[model samples]
Target: MMKHQIARVLVLVSIAGTCLSTASCQKTDPNRKETIPVCGEVYVDGQPAAMLQIQCHPVEGMDTQQPTITQAVTDQEGKFQLATYEAGDGAPVGEYKLTFVWQNFSAVAASYSGPDKLKKRYADPGKSPFPLRVEKGKQVDLGRIELSTK
Candidate 1:
């Protein structure tokens, strides 16, 4: 009699614990932004432009509780992976204006500042002609973006 009641109580507690754990695990914040992967390469005068920064800004009506600006750094081969919400995660779905900036570490260190090797027009987001869109659950591959040294 007493043993049966104790067993029933234990079973009920276990069921309740499982339900609570499942609910907590599935919980998601409504304000959390969703993102999709974006990647590309940068080129200068028909060659890969390495060690540069690439940024994407929402064109319009894309802002949320989370930021829409996605940024990436180019590798040795001029490859970049955009990250908005997290590292290498991706960017929110929207139209974006793209911009670039060369690291110029050697020039900065040598104090031989003259002008950007890849043209100054590529730096400003407002003036940049590169416009892109990110779609949900889709990976966007921006082919070689060419820049002129002259």
Candidate 2:
């Protein structure tokens, strides 16, 4: 009958629409799920260093610099976390120069000794320098810093 034909046509159209919708929803690629973290950590000479505490410069000769990334201080186990940016997080993605400066001082020498030379000379911290390259959005695990007494 004419009524039966019309009902069958309507049902077929609905099924087709449903199938198309489902297919479109299922077409998302697995690769699109990649994302970046908002933070991370750093290490120096096998000791966990504070994030953003170690200054990082993106380039040289630009005459510009960035702030230390805020990071948790290393725990007793020497563990830390680094900064992260979400996928498409609009953060600058590239290379950086990680700089660590040890500015040790002699409090007793500074107070008592008029001549700084006679005081015992240890790692000045002012002289201890650590520099490295870091790739953004990549894990930079600095295993150790082998320093020389010389």
TM-scores of all predicted structures: 0.70, 0.31
For every candidate, C-alpha RMSD to the true structure in Å: 5.1, 13.0
How much lDDT does candidate 2 score?
0.40
Q: How does residue 31 of candidate 2 score in lDDT? A: 34
Question: Looking at model 2, how many pairs of residues clash?
Answer: 15
How does candidate 2 fare on TM-score? Answer: 0.31
Query: Residue-wise lDDT of candidate 1 within 2-82, one digit each (tens)?
Result: 999999999999999999999999998677678788888888777887877788877784565564557987888988889
- Name the weakest run of 10 consecutive residues (lDDT summed) in model 2: 111-120
Candidate 2: where is the Cα deviation over 4 Å?
Answer: 1-52, 60-72, 84-92, 101-137, 146-150
- In terms of TM-score, which candidate is strongest? 1
Residue 127 lDDT in model 1?
88
Model 1, runs deviating above 4 Å: 1-30, 61-64, 106-115
Q: lDDT score, residue 64, model 2?
A: 35
